[model samples]
Target chain A: MWARTEEILPYALLLPSLVFLALLILIPMVQALLLAIQADSGEFTTAYLQRMAVDVNFNDAWRNTLLLIVLIVPLQIVLALAMALLVNSRFKGHQWFLYVYAIPLAISDLAAGILWLAVFTERGYLNTAAQGLGIVDQAKVYLSFENFGGLVAAIVIAESWRATAIVMVILVAGLQLIPRDFFEAADLFGANRLRRTLYVVLPLLRPSLQSALIIRTIFAFQTFAVVLALAGRNMPVIAAEAYSWYANNRDAHLAASYALLLLGLTIVFTFVYLRVLGLREAEVKR
Target chain B: MAGIRMQGIVKTFGKTTAIKEISLEVKDGEFLVLLGPSGCGKTTLLRCIAGLETVDAGRIFIGDRDVTDLPPRHRNIAMVFQSYAVFPHMTVRSNIGFGLRMKRVPKPQLERRVQEGAALLALEPFLDRYPAQLSGGQRQRVAVARALVMDAPVLLMDEPLSNLDALLRLQARADLKRLHREVKRTTVYVTHDQVEAMSMGDRIAVMREGVIEQCEPPMQLYTNPASQFVGGFIGSPPMNFLRGRTKAGAFEGEGFSLPMDGSRVEDGRELLLGIRAEQIRFGERGVPARVQVVEPLGATALVTVLVGKVPVKVDAPVNTTVRPDQNVSLAFEPADIRWMDATTGAALAH
Candidate 1:
């Protein structure tokens, strides 16, 4: 009887989570698929998907989404790697630096967007500082629709600032896992600071970097609140368009179609990241 | 091809002084081992010599060149870490060749040197495999191979065998000693294992509380320890220390009195007597003791006897019949006993 209970215990313990997945995720996903591929009469149709394809914001939203990911992911990786290396150095006041750097990780995305909006506004501190520094004659609008580059730059800066902390924290944990003896051995082998980072630290940080890239890339595809708060209708992302379709146009089917496209892109890129940066099981264990 | 000389080396971490003014010299091509318990500043002193730790006050010379202000990369040295810091991502061949590659030794020369190191360490078959695919011993060999490939004049090893199991440790220890002899470089090895120090080092420096208690050849250190700490630390099962006061020409303890060297200590003065476990002989005429435990170790047996409140061990042949709670008599030659200061724990000579 004890052996029988043991055999069934795993399945019994997994039952609640399975039920929750089916109710909350699997069912909703299937419903969204149906809504994307069927009409109101419950007959199969491509009308909603076609409408999504020809939507005015579709191309721009995806283009902007790809641009954000291409620009922000690499920038965040570099910044986070630098931050992690600095914190691991145990410089004076390193504990305070760690706490200060991770403060943004606790900040909500919407709150961060609102906070940056306050900074990049026409009379915000940035322009005020520019004016004070005599780089500009007066406080000028930087987040205006006419200045597309400026708007994208502001969004990139805001997102990079708000999210690099998390990547840095992950990399810091990975760095700590590596034995200090490795660095000392490298030094004894006559590796300079640059060589040590390139040959030892970076190669060893693959697992953490890969995870950070995948997570940040997926989040980049779904950028909405930050975009909406900063650029509103002036700049569009795939998630923002999905929201616009559901809330403004009252078309849940079209919204689900957009959401499916975003999901497809995220899945594709996640696979790319896994294929490019993934380590074998043995490598990670080692 | 060079020796190391450190004069008045000191290192401190914040308020805690890790290494108190240490002066040591390692002759060229000699294998010198720093043997001590954990946190005794052995590793710190080695790191200072490696240029990995900055000395608070001292001068370090590697073959007449002062390296006290230089960084580790400029020290012209190689080191093997206890964790076997072989790069997990690189093949054994690449790991061994890394230092050469950094020095920009042309590819052909680099490959030849790496091959030589691999052959020396018996790692030929595992060259193409990454460190993850190798066993613990093989990984440690890869670390050694990396250090050897550099062809540096000096090598530093920090407890490199403490991670291995007993059998592997013995095997690795023998390999390290053989390799040191073959290379004939000035080597500084740090470990807490006295057996490794005794078997491998040309000279062993026994340390305690950030100071060297005694530095001498292994046999000399074993025979003539400068302090009670070295005597206690350098021997297996440790040296038995009996605390008592000198009365007439004998040292008196709780339940026994042993004849002492007449001029060794002054009468009516407190003193301590140190004797090796193996030095004591079991016979019918000697100090009285009651056997408490007997441990059989292959060819030999260790018998623990209670003399008053003190426990003394006597090594006997395995064939001897000794059991727990048996009455026994133990004795040692007067020349075998070491007299030490009771208050200071320093060895005293007549």
Candidate 2:
């Protein structure tokens, strides 16, 4: 009897979480999948998916979302790597620098968007500084409705600034795991600073880089608040279209379809990142 | 193929000084070992020579070049770390050729040199294996091969074999000595194990605190240590010390007395008599003591005898019969006794 209880104990303890997942996550996911393919009369149809495919904003939303991911992910990785290396160097005041670099992680995505918007607004800090320096005669409209490039740049900068701290934290943890002797060996072998970073540090930091890329890309697929705050309706993203379809147009079916597409893109990118950055069996064991 | 010289090197970390104004010369093509206990600054001195640590007020020279201001890479020196810091993601071949690649050596020449290094270390079979796939000893060989392929003028090793098991350490030690003889690179090795120092060093610098107590050939260090610390550090079952004062042309302690040259010291000066365990023997006439313990080994036994209240150890033949509580006399030649000042721990002139 005791042996049976021991065997069943783990599942018994896990029952609450399993039921919670069923009600909150798994059930919603199944309902969303069904709602995306079902009509109000309870008959199967391709009408909602076809409508989502031909929506006026669909192409623009897909294009903008992909462009943001491409521009923002790599930029954030580079910036985070620099920050992690700087903090890892353990300079006189490196602890302070670490806390300062991580400050953005405490901010919300919408708040970060508004923060950058304050700088790029017509009469904000950038224009004020340019005007005060006599570099420009007037305040430039950097986020004007017609300036698609300006809007995209603004959104990219905001998103990168807001999300880079998490990547830096992960990279810093990875950096600390490497022994100091490796760097010393590289130094003694005549590796310059750049060569050491490129060959030694980067190759050893593969696991961390893989994780940071996957996490940032997945979150990037669901990016909505930052773009909504910065570009408003000027730029359309997949997440923003899903929200609009459900809340404004009262079309839950189309919203579910958009969510399914977002999920598919996340899975594809995650798989690609895994395939590219995966460690071999030997590397993982160490 | 180059000698290292440091002049008046001093290094301090915050309130503590790690290396105090010490200078030494290493001969070209010499195997110099820095031996000391932990925190004794031997590794720090080696780092200064390798350009890994900057000396506060000293100039370092590799061969004839003033390399104090040069980075380690510019100094043309290679070092094997204690951790055997082989790149885990790379195969042994790439690791061995990394330095050559950095120098942009021609492909054929780089491959040839890598092959030569692997052959020297018996790593030809493991060339394509990652460090994680190899054993501890194999990874250590990879580290050595990587440094050797650099063909640097100077080689620095910081306890490179200390992590291996005892049997492997012995084998690796012999292998390293043979490799050194063949390459003859000006090498500086740092370790705390006296056995490693004695067996491998052409010359040993014994350090204490932050200063070198004595720097001499291994046999010289064994037979004639300059200070009490060096004598105590360089031997297995270290040198025995007995505190006493000179009285009536004899050295007298708590439980024993031995005749000495009176003219060499004052009649009442306090001193310490140092003797090795192997140097003392059982005899019919000498200091008398009671046996305390007998530890038997294969060919020899360590007999602990109490002279007065102080226990003294003597290496004896294993077949000899002696038990605890038995009485015995310890004898030694007068010339073998080392006299040291009790307070300062410095050897006193005979």
Candidate 3:
């Protein structure tokens, strides 16, 4: 009896979910901003901003996060690409392999970091196995704080194992979407395997690559749990700095300042990613 | 360009055979089309010749070499797929030039070949554009251009025009015919459309269930189809089949009797009598019938008539006095009769 559009009354239905998001997501974000700028001094000065500029600890945190992004994202992309290509082939038990590779996607970063700890600790699996095999005469002194490269390596491996599956899944979908007709046509045209991959597969897969890279960059920029779990307080990341500024020193003002800096960095990185991908070129209409 | 010849080629997928012990030879510079209905393995046979699919048994020769196990690249056979497999990332220039690039042809030679292929397909204006930017017809031309630049001995197509709209299909067909005329390359084309098979092929192979029923010139395929399947599959408003019994020298059906050719008859045996819709005239001594439907095609009318219980169609001039439910005497001349074994469905000689 009533018009369908008029009968449903959509605003009432959408009101509850919007209210929940506003409380849970938006409010906390606003609180973090307020706390970052709160200036622990009685008078609001530029002290928190000065801490970001002159503090060696804050600079170390900045350097470490960038170093991880530089080292981790490209490695994840390459590993994921290789996995996707190997899994894409007509191999038996591909389904089981896919599940095995994808299992880390659901595992938390904290869990993965702890799992790697079992390998890297001084009396851990690596040294124990090396001693058992007679490769080492004594227990190897591993997990030393002085080893910066080891710390970076631990964090890189943790991030790669946990995050590479996303890129693989994206590439796998891209691979499937390529019509088999193209490969047959390429073969008829005398294209070898390498030629086909370059001339046929890579070109068609550009969009998938673009999206996968963007997502991985976003995830890498925010990497926290794995660094903390593996390297502990000795390793300084952006998020760990923010937590220490707020909780340990009881300086919410400096924490929010650090949070704002990380936010700015994230936005800048996203814009750069979007530009690098040339996202609009591949989508030109037929 | 070399002539393609296949001798006793056989291929099977799992337990089912897609192409049986078949043999065909395409002459140098001939446009040959393979025609059949869906699941008839015309495409499968084309792939076998292209070296994209390997035959389970038998040899394939391109001019003088046995190339049964050769990879498609080594065979140098180019194919236009029903879906044009244009590379999505590359510009039209690179896509057409890809075959040359793979051969490690000289830079100048590659550019010259790409230029020539682009000009042939009228793809010069869009050379900088990727396949995603081209129209369907343009993509098809690029696909053909991709094949052409190879300069391979054989150009094989697997229902390349099936994806186009009816109007584009007609244009593409005419273009294909013209292209073949100019190049005079030995080509193997496959389609289910009989008109395409008829208009394009110098020799047509009519197939059914993985076996070629008949291989001959298009006119022979239309006029003297070697099997009941070929007869039924070829013509547009296809051949009309009627069940009849031979007694003495006469063939008796439901509504009327036709005098049998003694050479065609097995005495006192039941058989199928086939007549093309165009073969039987309207105003002749055929069979008495009532007009059930008259479909007015441009210059001719397909008149569907019911004689006793059997439905029959006759092609007559557009201005025939046939109306639904009207009675008329339709005639069948002895010359129009093709006798077939009703049980086996094989054509019997008259």
Candidate 4:
């Protein structure tokens, strides 16, 4: 009796969270799949998914979402690695710099979008500064409706600035796990700084880089508020399209289809990241 | 092979001075050991020579080049850290060949040098294994191989065997000495273990409070330490010190007296008598004391004797039947005694 209770005790304690997860996530995921694949009459059909595939905004949303991910993820990783290395150097007042760099993490995605919008919007800070410096005779419309590149650039900058801190934090944790002696050994062996970082530091940081890539890419797939705030209808992303289908058109089935597509993309990218940065047990242990 | 020369090297960490105007010469192909206690700046000095730590005020010369301003890479030196520092991501072969790879050595030569280093350290079978797959001793061998394959003129080791088990350390010590003899690289090793210094160092520099107290051959350091600190640091059980005053051509302390040799001494001047445990014997007709403790080793027993409240240790044969509370007389040879000035702790010249 005692052995049975001991074996069942952990699961008994976890029952509430398991139930909560089923209700909040698993059940909704099943519902979404059903809604995506079935009609209101409770018969299996491909009508809603086909409608999502042929929607007017579907192609633009797919292209914009992929472009954003491709542009933002790599840019954030490089910036985060540089920031992590700078913070890890432990120079004087580095704590202040770390705190400042992490300030973006405390901001909401929409707030970050609005923050950058203030700089790029017409008569905003950039134009004001350019005009004050006599670099431009008139205020430039950097985020105008016809300027698709400007809108995409604004969204990329905002998203990279806001989300790079998360990658930086993970990388900093990884950098700390490496012994200082490895770097000293590299220096004594006559490796230049760049080569040392490329050969020694990067290989050791694979696990962290893998995690950062997966997390940022998944978050990038779900990006909505930032783009909605910065580009409005000028750019369409997968999440924005899902929201438009559900809230504006009152079509939950099409929204569910878009959400399923986003999920599929996230899984594929995560799998690719895991396979590319796979580590042996020996490398992981130390 | 090249000698290392440092002229008036000084390093300070904020308000605390770590190395204070230290200058030393390491001869070509010399295996010099910097032996000191923790925080003695021995490791710091070794790093300064390696160009890992820049001296605040000094000029460093590797062979004949003034390398004071050069980074470690440009200095053409190799270092084996105490942690072994084998790259976890790379195999032992890659680690051994990493320096050559950095220098872009030809593939054939790189492979040959890596093989030679692996063979020297008996790491041939473990070449394809990552550092995490190997034992601590094997990893240490990989670190040494990595340094040796560099074929750099100067090699710096910061207590490389310190992380190994005691039994492995003994084995590694002998292997390192033999390797050093074979390679003939100018190596500067930092360690706090006196046994390692005595067995491996061609010359040992005893450091204290950021300065070298004495730099000499192992036996010379044992026999003739420049100061009381060096004498106390270099020996097991250390040198026994008895405080006394000189009067009537004899030095008399709490419960002991020894005749002063040819050295001129003022009447009633304060001094300390330094003698090793082995130099003092329990025999007939000398200073009498009560045996407080008897610690037995396989070959010998250390008997602690108290003479008028001052405890002095004497080495006795292991089979001796000495028990606690028994009284014994300790005999000291005049030639074995070192007289030190009590105030400055400097060895008095005879």
The chain B TM-scores of all candidates, as shown, are 0.97, 0.98, 0.96, 0.97
Model 4 Cα lDDT, one tens digit per residue, A8-49: 999999999999999999999999989888899999999988
Score residue A172 of candidate 2 by CA lDDT: 97
Cα lDDT tens digits, model 1, A1-286, are 9999999999999999999999999999999888898888989998988888898888888899999999999999999999999999999999898999999889899999999998999988888889899999978888988999989999999999899998999899989988898888788887888899999988888888888888888888888878888899899889998899889989999999998898899889989878887876655455
Poorest lDDT segment (10 consecutive residues) of candidate 3 chain A: A36-45
Error of 2 at B181 (Å): 0.9
Label model 1 with its docking quality class: medium
The list of candidate 2 runs beyond 4 A from truth reads A1-23, A40-46
Sort the candidates on DockQ, descending order: 2, 4, 3, 1
Can you tell me the CAPRI class of model 4? Answer: medium
Q: Write the per-residue lDDT of candidate 4 for residues B140-217, one digit (tens) a residue.
A: 999999999999999999999999999999999999999999999999999999989999999999999999999999
Give one digit per residue, the lDDT tens place, for model 2 in B1-350.
78999899999888899998889999999999999999999999988888888888889999999999999889989889899889988888999999999888999999999999999999999888788888899989999999998999899999999999999999999999999999999999999999999999999999888898999999988877788899999988788888899999999988788889878798989998888999998899888889999999778999888888877888999987878999888899988988999889899876
Best by TM-score: 2
Error of 2 at B310 (Å): 2.7
**Candidate 3: residue B102 lDDT (0-100):** 87
Residue-level lDDT for B215 in candidate 4: 95
- Backbone clashes in candidate 2 total 0
Local distance difference test values of all predictions, in order: 0.90, 0.91, 0.85, 0.91
Error of 3 at A30 (Å): 3.2
